[model samples]
Target: AVLGQRHEKNFRPIHYASKIITEAELNYTTTEKEMLAVVKVQLNELNELRDQAYENSLIYKEKTNRLHNSNIKDRVFNIGDRILLFNSRLKIFSGKLKSRWSGLFSISYVFPYGTVELSQPDEPSFKVNGHRLKHYFGGDRPKLVVPDLQTFPKDQ
Candidate 1:
């Protein structure tokens, strides 16, 4: 049986080809030859199913890639632009509330096909997938003001 994605909704079997194995086909094995003979048939039909599975898999892959790429915006970073790198391997034992991004890295170089070279202050530059990067707007800092003593409360 071969299954395929006819629509984006669900998977449905597109084709099914079956052949029952005979006694001669199961000549060697001492196991349940009766059941084996009734089941496997020839490798040819299985091979056809395998080929169909591969073709269907390719279609699924293409569709998945299309859907994924759709959500991705093309980002072009200039040299010295601040960016954050997403930690792709941080899934294990990590809380979802914690940030997976690990950079205040600057773009040292940009290349084709969503590849980037990033460098952090006092650290060596490294190449990473550009999909893992996003622009950084700098960290937040609060301003402090000193008031004159004349405006200060004397009760304390």
Candidate 2:
């Protein structure tokens, strides 16, 4: 089905084309089926290259997504750790410019399957998805100081 974008950004069926496959063509492998379909459509060489390039770009996107996700370190939160919670629910007066994350909530309990119980000083505890929370550094710098490592350790 060929769809064209309409004025309201909705898709409209510009044209619809269909073809019946023969028994011999049905026997082709999945990869062969794709190439065969391109040929059966009688598209020009440029059109065929355009289609192939779209498919190749999709494969490249999948590979890049895998590599990008692999580089993201897993976040682990302890019971007492401070975290910021992501607000996914829309608010009536909240505009797009408003910050989505709202906390320095402390983790009181951690449940299985990425569920966490959070609480603040005067606020009641509430459960939220662990994926929505990120570690909060609380405006304090880490105390650990790195000693000079330029010289080799004294031969001890």
Candidate 3:
């Protein structure tokens, strides 16, 4: 089994800002008009860069939303430790407390807004709260493994 490092995210910014552009050096020798033109051009470029950044953010957000909305919680599942959603079912209204350990809840009902719902195997549909579903008693069934296989005679 290959285990990787765990990154716990708690609503903290990963890198406050991504791809910061240094302000262009001022050309004092140039005329005011020329300087204004240069400023406009630089400003346009900056606007373009900002737009691209916003677009990238939207894409990232969409992906995150998709992953969160998916019922397959095991894949890309992160609670309070990474990305967070808004409202969810069962225990709706999560306060961005996502963690790897927290996301390991039920295998069913994953959605945005950081809330999940689960269904018990023996029991019918029942809503669970906060990653941890309400505990239920198991059926009193006989063990499938026989006593002979469970314990061998010392004499033999």
Query: Which predicted model would earn the best TM-score?
Result: 2
- Residue-level lDDT of model 2, residues 35-131, one tens digit each, is 6655645565568899999999999999999999999998888899989888877465669788777867899999988899999889899999999
Clashes in each model (backbone N, CA, C under 3 Å)? 0, 0, 11
TM-score of each: 0.44, 0.48, 0.32
Q: Which ten residues in a row have the lowest lDDT in candidate 1?
A: 33-42
1 versus 2: better TM-score goes to: 2
In model 2, the worst 10-residue window by lDDT is: 1-10
What tens digits encode model 1's per-residue C-alpha lDDT throughout 1-156?
A: 232335777767544445545667556554554344334445557888999999999999999999999998768788888898888788776597887877588899989888889997788989998878889887732344786767656895
Residues 96-140, candidate 3, lDDT per residue (tens digit)? 654212222233555675355544346554333344432222343
Which portions of model 2 show Cα errors greater than 4 Å? 1-55, 89-98, 139-156
**Sequence-dependent TM-score of model 1:** 0.44
Off by over 4 Å in 3: 1-30, 71-156
lDDT of 3 at 63: 97
* TM-score of model 2 (CA atoms): 0.48
Question: Would you give me the overall lDDT of model 2?
Answer: 0.79
